[model samples]
Target: MKKAVTILFVLVFMCGGFMQAQVVKSISLNSGMVWSTQKFDYKDINYDLPNEYLTGFHIGFAVEFLQHEYFSILTEIGYTQKGFKLEVDITTPDFPEGGLGTMEIKYSYKYAYLSPMFKVRKEFRGFIPYVFIGPRLDYLLEYPTDEFSEESAKYFNDFIFGMTYGLGLEYMFGSFGVGLIFQNQYDFTLAYHHELEEGYDSGVDIKNNAFILDLGVKFYFGKE
Candidate 1:
């Protein structure tokens, strides 16, 4: 949408100013474990199946804006997977000639995600502890492979906005840094909507959430 592009452009312009004015830079390679699920909200319909967490992996690269051991801006970009597993119970007298059957289905979606965060840290004897909070933007990579068709994919969103918050610890080995971080990610949009032929949606329908633990290797310059 035009409005979304405008907002993104403004944020990029502001970040460029900050980068030019202040002077510290670090680049990192990161990957982690993700436990994700879809939560549903509805006014009239309810999902009867039991949903559980789906496990996936996240790998990314991050750039830092400052060298001050106290505060900085971190911008990260990564490819990740998020989804839920559903358990459904049904009587199978006709389909399989059995009395009961339970079917387990998992829905996995791939995304390109970006996070630009404010990082604050304290350093003591080559060890650093930090916390970060940021806004996350996710772009859908493709329709899920299971139970999703091209027609059904139109109801899904291509881009969604969310929040990512976490805490991490790092150790400095001269010019190199290694860290492990714990993060919580939550999206604020519907996975599916039925009003394409009608009008705008009123409220949330289904949202995605995840818990992540990441490990990273960092290279820094302009540090004290």
Candidate 2:
């Protein structure tokens, strides 16, 4: 955990080296759809549950540092909603036509994320195509705790380490630009430790993964 946190801070500072490096090129605001889910690694083979992707949203702003015409660094801060929905069907007599009722357990989490990425792009006429990849750090803002006891809920990991990568296309109209970006975040750290009251550690690991599609609007500050 110490190593992970250190690495995240280092990457963040590296990407935010605007003073020592190049000039600021642009600042952009982005927001759109987020599809997220959790993958579980169970220590005991007999225990498992079903999970499905939850459709959510994310909003953020980014600062781009331009070192050259074809390369730059992007530092982003964002808020995103992610989780999963578990549904089960049971036979019931409440319905006259059909005796089936669906019960759902929805787990929702909110996070604030920081991403420092390297971008490679090329401009074709007025169109720009780009690709970016970086390491990301996410802080858990809120999580569903109604399902767990207070002591157990405390096991939730507040910090998450992940990787961010994406491809995007933009149309530049003078100093203003509009773009479509498709990105994915895959976490290397566990979302929760989930060690129940029983002293024996089950080591049930849960990790988060998300797919994002954002419409980015940018305003160029100056040409580098």
Candidate with top TM-score is 2
Report how far off residue 134 is in candidate 2 (Å). 0.3
> lDDT (0-100) at residue 116 of candidate 2?
87
Model 1's lDDT to the true fold? 0.79
Tens digits of per-residue lDDT, candidate 1, 1-224, equal: 45444655665676567657665477788899999998866544454436899999898777788667599988877778899898776655475654476777788888777899999999889999999999998887755755867755677888889999999999998889999999998887765665423343332356789888999999877555
Whole-structure CA lDDT of model 2: 0.84
Per-residue CA lDDT of model 2 for 50-127, tens digit only, reads 888999989978888865889998988888998888997755567555447677878899988889899999999989
What stretches of model 1 exceed 4 Å from their correct place?
1-22, 46-49, 90-101, 195-204
TM-score of 1: 0.80
Candidate 2: deviation at residue 21, Å?
A: 9.5
